[model samples]
Target chain A: MRSDVLVGAVSILFGMAYTVQTLHLPKAMVGNPWAPLFFPLALGVLLVAMGIVVLLKGLRHHPSSAKKGGSKRLIVVTILICLAYTALFERIGFIPSTILFLGGLLFAVNGAKAWIVNSLIAVTFSFGVWYVFEKIFYMNLP
Target chain B: MELIQNLLLGFSVVLTPLNLIWMVAGSILGTILGMLPGLGPTTGIALLLPLTFTMEPATALITMCAVYYGAMFGGSRSSILLNVPGDGAAVAACFDGYPMAQNGRAEAALAISAIASFIGGLIATVAFVIVAIPVARFALRFGPPEYFMLMIFALSATAAISKEALFKGFISLLVGLMISTVGIDYQTGVLRFTFGLMELQTGIDFVVVIIGVYGLGEVFKNLENIASGGGLQAIQKKFGRIWITLDDWRRSIIPILRETPVGFLVGVLPGAGATIAALMAYNNEKQLSKEPERFGTGTIEGLAAPEAANNACSVGALIPMMTLGVPGSGTTAVMLGALMILGLQPGPLLFQQHADVAWAVIASMFLGNVACAFINIPLAGLLVRVLAVPPKVLYPVIVALAFVGVYTINFSVVEFVLLILFGLVGYGMKKYKVPTAPLILAVVVGSSMEQNFRMALMLADGDFGVFFRNGICWTLFFLAIGSIAWPFLSSRIKLPWNRS
Candidate 1:
């Protein structure tokens, strides 16, 4: 699918969902017609209108460039690494998690060359920053 | 005399030993961060913000402002040497700056930018001091209706000036406004769009969003390039004298003087900042030059105008932020968030209520600009070497630091997850050519807009006509309409001079 079409479709879905949610919000008290839903409903309508325009424009025009092949894999893999790091952050503790995350990312991007240097850099940065934030700034890290 | 007294009080506050030390330290740190690829003032300020959580408001604000000024000065170094802009505002500098470096005038280019930035910052600070008091006083008369219209005008102006498609800008803005509504609605005691999550009650934190969008999102964008071993590399150059001669100074003085006010005026308009100012100033210089063809080559006017304009614009951006409580750019929006975090409300009452903090910040700008220029000129060679750090190594460290920075705020895993999610969203937005500035700005202003709207409606017993009754309100409404229509109208309206 074209990028604009995808954007428009997502936006329409979001607008509809939010509109439904807004309708469920409690109404304003007596003598007050201005409810919690007023502003969001207005925005929802604007979003739907803008979505239609974007969708039509997308359908009318073709994309100038096709998607490239390799970068998608790199981006996905990196996001997964970050997610894994975040998930294990508190469980494994800050220093170990940071070292693993940094080393993993470095190895993933640069490939497993010079294991000593990569390990050293990962260890040094994680511990060095931890020391500064913990000792100097007095910020508690998990 | 009153201005002089306040300035004296401000100087006393900033001249304290601790504040002065932080200013110098911030300048050095900001220069290093600015020279690094993918980290500008916004990211620099965001990353350093957590450290200031325990300091006095004056100290915290001055340090952050110093960082901002230093980043603006340091941005030109990478632009000149490697033809890679360290920040969006430095993009214009690359045109003439890189060519000058290629022609073996790297030192001269560096020196001129440093001097121009210094002069620009000094003049803009003076302008800021002169304008801030009156702007604040004028804003004291704004009721909720006028305030609402002003925000609308801000949103419309942002949409109009966005480099993306017009509708896309509006879409981004609306999305931000919607996201802002996710927490509990302050009025009527209703839970909004929370979907039963306990954490959603407090709304999304803007600082988390900023770190995610700028820090992690940029990391994701550069991941492929780093994988391919194609990230930024330092340009090798020898620094000789690092000073411009008399001829260079003679040519630069006029352009600097001309571009500073242009930059300042443009920057005072909400959502317009250094990037636009620099681009406009560069174009204006080209038009005024006798040899316009030499602009993209190695021209002193080309280098001086943009360098000065961007620095002036950085200071000019503070005018609205400090006085009217509206951020003129994404960086200023972050600064506003910082101010709020420090328990300071940056509106008209700020000058009256927090006069000490406000004046100290203004005075610090004067000291920060001079300090940054002095440091940058002597340390240009050292700062440029920061670019040599491999992105593969540097980015991961940045990611780690980002996680730690966000975590230090609340120590919540959920917020960390939100950071990663917004990072992905930011990456997607960048891929789709959606402007992030409008979205961030909207997020900053959405709640305030809602508060003003509700208050105005309450004051008028829910009459919509209340929005148009006042002169200021009507003026702002028309300005909003004009701004939204200007982009489409400019292309269609053929001038008489072009009727041939």
Candidate 2:
């Protein structure tokens, strides 16, 4: 599918769904009952209209020869690493989970061939950031 | 007389020891962040946000402003040396800047960029000083209807006035607006599209989106580039001399002066930013030059004009954000949001309510511009060593910092989840060839836009005609319509009346 067409279709679906959700918002006990719904409802309708225009425009154009979504797997791996980091953050603490997260990303993207260097960087960045935020700023981390 | 007193007041605020330290620190950090691809002023300020939480409002703003322009300066460094722009605002620099490096005049190109930027920024700051007070005073007269109209003009112009991607801009904007609607409604205390998550009830912070898109999103995108064998290139080590010659200086001075105003004008308009200003300066220089063909071939005029205009544009863009509280671009939106968090809200009353803070921000722009040039030039050789650090390791560190930045927000792991999610969203937007500016700008302006609109409605007793009750409203309405129409009209049809 053409990119614009796919995006447009997604937008239309999103807009319609959003409109329904806006409609279900609890009625306001104060001020106009319609006030909360007004802006969002307009946004939903406009998004659907914009989607149609984009879809129509995409239909008129010839298929593009743009570069394929290069390195899809790499992106997936990074996201998974991040997800694991998020899940582990509170349980494992900032220092340990961050090192694992950074180390994991480095290994995946930078390659394990330079394992020692990547490990060092991940460890150093994790510790350095912790020291600054916790010690200097008096801001806590999970 | 009043102007001089205000200038002194501004200087006094900036001269404080704490403010000076933060300003210098911000300039240094901002340059480093700006030099990296995918990070711009937005990411730079957002990443440093937690640091500013402990600072005085003036100090925090000063530091962020330093980062804002410092990144603009550093952005051109990569454009000249590596033939890649650090951000969107630096794209025009690549047109002639890269060719200059290729010609082994990298030193000259680097020097001229700093010089032009310094002169341009100083002049633009002067203009800002002259206009800021008047503009703020005038803005005091604006009511809810006027503000709502202004919001419409800014949003529609942002969506409509791009060189291309008009519809894509709209899509990006609507998505941002939708994101803005996610939290609980303020006036009526209605729960919004919170999806049962307590975090959603408070609303998704725009700072998280910035960190995700600019920091993590760029990293995600870079993984693709690295996989495709398009990682950052090796750096050049030596330069014969780092200063521009009198000959190069003579050619550049005129274009730099001419373009600063153009850039400043465009910067004041909502939705426009340094990228547009730089491009316009480049185009204007090309048209006026005797050797227009020399443009893409590394002409000094081409390089200097864009460099000057973009820096000037950064300074000029601050006017609207500071004076009227309507940010014209993503960078300013980030600044506005960060400042609001710092408890120094920018708007018509800012100068009246917090005159010291307002003027200090203006003064800091001049200092930041100068500080960035100092960093980018004398330390150009030292800084390029950073580029030698392989992207493989650098990207991961950036991701860690992004998480840390978000974590600083509420010190919650939940914010990290939101960061990653927005990062993915940012990556998706990139893949689909959509611009991120309108999306971010919308997110920052979204809540306030809705608030002003509702307030206007409430005061007018639900009569829609209240919007058109004033001249300012009509002016904004017309400007918005014109901006939306121009893209379609400019290409498709030319009437006979145009023949005259």
All models: lDDT?
0.85, 0.86
TM-score for each prediction? 0.96, 0.97
Q: Model 1, B93: alpha-carbon shift in Å? A: 0.6
Q: What fraction of native interface contacts does model 2 preserve?
A: 0.90
Clash list (residue pairs), candidate 1: none
Question: Which regions of candidate 1 are displaced past 4 Å?
Answer: A27-34, A67-70, B492-500
Structure candidate 2, residue pairs in collision: B271-B328
> Which 10 consecutive positions of candidate 2 chain B have the poorest summed lDDT?
B491-500
- Measured by TM-score, how close is model 1 to the native structure? 0.96
DockQ for each model: 0.61, 0.85
Instruction: Give the top-scoring candidate (DockQ).
Output: 2
DockQ of 1: 0.61
Q: Write the per-residue lDDT of candidate 1 for residues A1-142, one digit (tens) a residue.
A: 3888878887888888888888887676644645677899999989988888887888789775767633666678777888898899989999999999888877876668857878998899889988988898888888
